[model samples]
Target: MEKNLRLRKNEDYKKVYSRGFRFYNKDFNGLCLDSKNNGPRVGFTITKKYGKANMRNRTRRRLKEIVRLNRDILPNLDIIIVPKKHTYTMDFNSLNDSYLNLIYFMNKRYKRK
Candidate 1:
């Protein structure tokens, strides 16, 4: 992912978590808020309970790639993706589908400009 398209600040994550609209399914959870930037910015979060550092890093990488591939269609928003334990063992295609589904619903529900 590009540096400008990533949510890196602690305050940014906290603001999204505290105030953003949330969506989720069996695979992952997402929080999104209106962005001040020109394009969508994304962040991946995996807790210690999810797994060790290596496992969490792997899951983060997969999610990042999924977002990177579809970044152009995304809205101008700040999004935080929280992957569940199920994501670690899930196939790439399935994970991509899950992400797309989440984004589809989010777009339908939040009519942001």
Candidate 2:
């Protein structure tokens, strides 16, 4: 994703983690806070407990790709996607579907307020 559209700072992640509205599915959880910048920004976090570096990187890549493809439709918010353990073994198509579902859920829930 583009640098301007990424949540890169430690404080940014912490703000989302501590105060953002949350949405979730069996595959992952999303934390979203209204954006303070010109557009939406996203970040991904996969704990070391999930796997070795390679596996974590692969999962991060999958999530990032999904977001990149759908960036135009995303609302103007700051989002952090945290994947569950199940994602490690899941196929990309299924993972994509799950991530989209979670985004749909976020849109519905976040927009009501």
Candidate 3:
């Protein structure tokens, strides 16, 4: 993903975590906050509990790809994805499916608000 489309600052992530709506699943947590930008911005968080550097990086890449593929469906929001340990074992297709499900759930929840 491009740098411009990423949530970079610590404050940005905190804002989303504290004020945004959240969705959780077996593999990841999704937090979404309304954004001023015209396009969605995303961030990924993977800790040592998931694995070593390489494993965590792999998980981030997979998540990024999933987001890229579904960017059209995502609204103009700041989204933070926090991956669980099981996320490291999921293949790309499974990861994509799970993330999409969360995105759909998020959209539905946001619409109700």
Against the reference, the lDDT scores of all candidates come to 0.89, 0.89, 0.85
Put down candidate 3 lDDT per residue, 1-113, tens digits, no spaces.
77878999999988998998888877778889999777789999887887899998888888888887788898778999898888788788898888988888887787524
Top candidate on TM-score is 1
- Residue pairs that clash (backbone atoms under 3 angstroms), model 3: none
Weakest lDDT window of 10 consecutive positions for candidate 2: 104-113
Rank ordering of all candidates by TM-score, starting from the highest: 1, 2, 3
Error of 3 at 59 (Å): 0.3
Q: Candidates sorted by lDDT, descending order?
A: 2, 1, 3
Give the alpha carbon lDDT tens digit for every residue of 1-113 in model 2.
Answer: 68877999999999999989988899998999988999999999899999899999999888888888989888899999999987999998999899889888888879635
User: Candidate 1: which stretches are off by over 4 Å?
Assistant: none
Worst ten in a row by lDDT for model 1: 104-113
Which whole-number lDDT from 0 to 100 does residue 72 have in model 1?
76
Model 2 regions more than 4 Å off: 111-113
Task: Mark the regions of model 3 whose C-alpha exceeds 4 Å error after superposition.
Answer: 111-113
* Cα lDDT of model 1 by residue, 24-112, tens digit: 87888989999988888999889999989999998989888998998877878899889989789999999999999888878888866
